[model samples]
Target chain A: MRAVVVDDASPVPSFEQVRSQVAAMIRSGELSPGEHLPPVRQLAADLGLAKNTVAKAYAALESEGLVVGDRRRGTLVLAASASPETDRVRRVEMAERAAVRYLAEVGHLGFPAVDAIDVVRRVASAD
Target chain B: MLGDWLSIVVLGGLSSLIFVSGLGPFTDRMLDRWCLRYDVAVDQHGREWLRTQLRRARAWRWCGFAVGTVVSALPMYANVIDRNRAADFATPANRFAPWLLAAAGSVVGELLSRRPPGGRRAAHLATRHWRDYCSSRWVAVVGWSVPVSVAFAVQATQSRDLGWRWSWLGPAVALCGSAAVTVGLRHLVNRPGAPDGLDRLVDDALRADSAHHLVGASVALAGLGTSHAALALDLGWLGLLVGMGQWLAIAAWWYVARQETWNVARVRWSRS
Candidate 1:
């Protein structure tokens, strides 16, 4: 399995780092549907994270229908979106990557990502 | 006298050979066999990396053996042969010399085996992983602390019985030593950065390394307890039991460390 790198020094919290990375992996088809992710405890230990942090990330992924957690089995990946297609996956991957880059850019410019999103929403409403 | 020196030479030489040359290849062969049995495909680069590590380890072990032999021989000559003060050839210092030599040798070996460029990034990632592990498992930190506390209590009680006006001295020292060792192991193993290749295997390797450190610490404590029981409490049987426990712990540690290291290699290859 491809390892997720979490940067503690970044403004992003560990759980967000985990969540986004897992999401990206799913969208990129690196983690396929029905593939089991590592156990929460194991991943937490591997990443030197609190088990809760990883659990929270997994929970977020589950809520988004990106993965499912079973008591007997482990956490398994689900389709990234409503339908699985090469183009759809590509679009989702690109969108996610763009969002990350935009957020990072805005942050570097000393603006909140939410403010930028609000500005985009206002423009869309006017249009 | 001649026989004693000869025996030391033979034993030291054999130990050096086994530690420096024999174990690495033996471990590698076992890893290969296990991987084959499990249908794990090891990448060429991963295999090369593992081999390189083994080579470095062997060199360290040899260096340690050589240093230990020379240092130990000095005491044997001066205390036993030259002075004829005692028939006992194995003084405490002499017995400890090899381990000291080995420790120094390993450090030197590590220094010599510098990672290539981009190693820093790998190391940073590994450290971050380790920090996450430690932070998440706060309970484990507490678990380790319990042993050190217990050790302190044991030492303190013994010291008081031995009529030390400063009973806390022994306990304080013991506590500091245990804490230092625990912290040192955590830092040492985690500092190297994450192993490249299979994430699963890297996790297993880290787990195994942690287990090895915990077991090693337990063994050390058991030895300390045994010594205390025998020397302080005059409980020979109890000391014997503790000594046996220590050996058992050591045996378990060896098995886990060996198996996990190989498993780590397997994962690295399988992923590669």
Candidate 2:
């Protein structure tokens, strides 16, 4: 029954909350590999979130290999990878993509370079 | 002159009595029965979270009652300030205040009733709709202003005579708003882009449509009550029937509205 709430008040959607929380939990080893996540419908109802929100989050988790989906068995967290090198590489890639998206969004939003950096720094620090 | 004012008091008293005695219990029973029967917000899976929200909702009911009492009484205070105190007691302002209080109370009651107990999942669901206060439910952004603005505009006018013009105006506006809600809810439910599981979700919601229909019935009854009050204004034998009908409708509407609000409140959400 334990679940986390990303800022519900934030402009961020509930699915994003599910995605980030599940990811954070996996990284922290709180939800060990092989732990059965609650069924999407039940979890969504439990969280007052839309059912699709949880489904989307689960889809993301599955794609990252942090969780495994078996049609018959349902979804389960996979054991954490043994390779630190692979983990480091994945983290760097994620960070790079996030930076590119942030910069592009800032430029499009019409913020000056210095202001955009400040905004990024603030968001990063808050997170 | 005093006799005329007394008659108005008697009329208002009778109407209030019906609402308090008959409609109050009726609404409570309907709420219980509807909750037991279809359970529009049932989380076949989130049993524990559902229970927690119910508890919060129960607490909110008490809060609704308290807040409703205050809001309803405020109009009575205004009536007291008027030079025609006794006559104004039966004015539309005083009579309408209680119903508004009750509706406002329902919201507070609903929120209080659904507070989360603990645990990550429960907490997650409890806060799930927080963004709704900001974005998704933009209608809610104007929620408080609409009614208050309407009430103030109507009450601030100098006319003290009770007539169909103002009474009908209030309900007409309400009906229009409800119609908008029904249409919007229908559209949201119909969206094809909804997640694969949305069909089941909407199906579950639709299964309780009968309950929603009952709310419609309640509204119709309340309309009847207003019609009766309008009839009674003439101070004829017909007024008796009109007054009686108005109170009956008030009670019915109150019951139906209670059920609908409860149904809406039971929906537990997750991160989505």
Best by TM-score: 1
What's the residue-level lDDT of A91 in candidate 1? 56
Please state the interface RMSD for every predicted structure, separated by commas. Answer: 7.9, 9.7
Residue by residue across B163-244, what tens digits does model 2's lDDT show?
Answer: 5555444444344434433443333222211122222333333323322332333243234434533442344686577557
lDDT of 1 by residue, B1-272 (tens): 67667766776676666565634553668547644533445666655554555466456646675667666766555554565654455444464355445444543443343332221111111212232222223224324534554554566566546544233332332343245345544544433333445334543343334434333333333333333333344455774775465355335424433443334343333344
Give chain B TM-scores in order. 0.56, 0.42
Off by over 4 Å in 1: A1-127, B19-40, B58-74, B84-185, B192-230, B243-246, B258-272
State the TM-score, rounded to 2 decimals, of chain A in model 1: 0.63
How many Å off is the CA of B198 in candidate 1?
6.4
List lDDT for all candidates, in order: 0.53, 0.47
Top-scoring candidate (lDDT): 1
Model 2: per-residue Cα lDDT over A24-54, one tens digit each: 8878787776677766655665566677888
Q: Model 1, residue B264: displacement in angstroms? A: 13
